[model samples]
Target: MAESTYTVTGMTCGHCVASVTEEVTKIDGVTGVDVDLPTGAVKVTSAAPVAEADVRAAVEEAGYALAG
Candidate 1:
């Protein structure tokens, strides 16, 4: 398995986390998601390394920005 951490912006509440999680969970191979709204930290665990482009797109789909 593989894990990656990303900083997502504009996450301020439970709904924010849920939205991000929903989008990211759609990615193939993703096994888990952990989001810390206060710090905008999102840790993603997957069966394989996930592509950066896919992560970014997922974040966008959730109405947020993935920090560079």
Candidate 2:
């Protein structure tokens, strides 16, 4: 499996984490999603390397922003 770490902004609660997780998990090849609310850290595990743009879009769709 491949793993990638990203910083997500605007997540404030469990619902935010759930939203982010749900959107990210919908991506192709994504095996799992772990979100750290305190740190805004999102770790994505996938069968292959996922594109940053795809992840960004997913985060946006969840009403969050991907930190640069």
Candidate 3:
């Protein structure tokens, strides 16, 4: 599996985490998603390397932004 970590902005609670997780989990080949509320860290595991644009779109769909 391939793993990637992204910093997401505007995530403040469990609901935010859920929203982000839900959207990110929808990406093709995504096997898992884990979000750390305090650090705004999102870790994704997939069967193949996921595109950065796809991750950005998913985060935006979840009403958040991917931090640099």
Candidate 4:
């Protein structure tokens, strides 16, 4: 498995965390997710290779922007 961390901006509360988590968890290769609200970071564990574009799409669908 591999891990990736995405810096998400505009996550201001627990609801934001839940929303993002749910959105990201829907991705095909995602096996796990950890959201740190204070840091606005999301750690994703995957069983196989996952594209950054997919990750970015997920975050964007959740109504937040991923920071580069």
Which ten residues in a row are the worst by lDDT in model 3? 59-68
lDDT of 4: 0.95
Candidate 1 residue-wise lDDT, 1-68, digit = tens: 99999999999899999999999999999999999999999999999999989999999999999987
Query: Which lDDT tens digits does candidate 3 get at residues 1-68?
Result: 99999999999899999999999999999999999999999999999999999999999999999987
Give me the runs in candidate 1 sitting further than 4 Å from their true place.
none
TM-score to native of every candidate shown? 0.97, 0.98, 0.98, 0.96
Q: For residues 1-68, could you state the per-residue lDDT of candidate 4 as single tens digits? A: 98999899999999999999999999998999999999998999999978999999999999999997
Candidate 1 vs candidate 2: which has greater lDDT?
2
Q: Cα deviation of 52 in candidate 3 (Å)?
A: 0.7
Is 3 or 4 the stronger prediction by TM-score?
3
lDDT of 2 by residue, 18-63 (tens): 9999999999999999999999999999999999999999999999
Residue pairs that clash (backbone atoms under 3 angstroms), model 2: none
Q: What are the per-model C-alpha RMSD values against the true structure?
A: 0.5, 0.4, 0.4, 0.6
Q: lDDT ranking from best to worst?
A: 2, 3, 1, 4
Off by over 4 Å in 3: none
State the lDDT at 16 in candidate 2: 99
For model 3, name the residue pairs that clash. Answer: none
Better of 1 and 4 by lDDT: 1
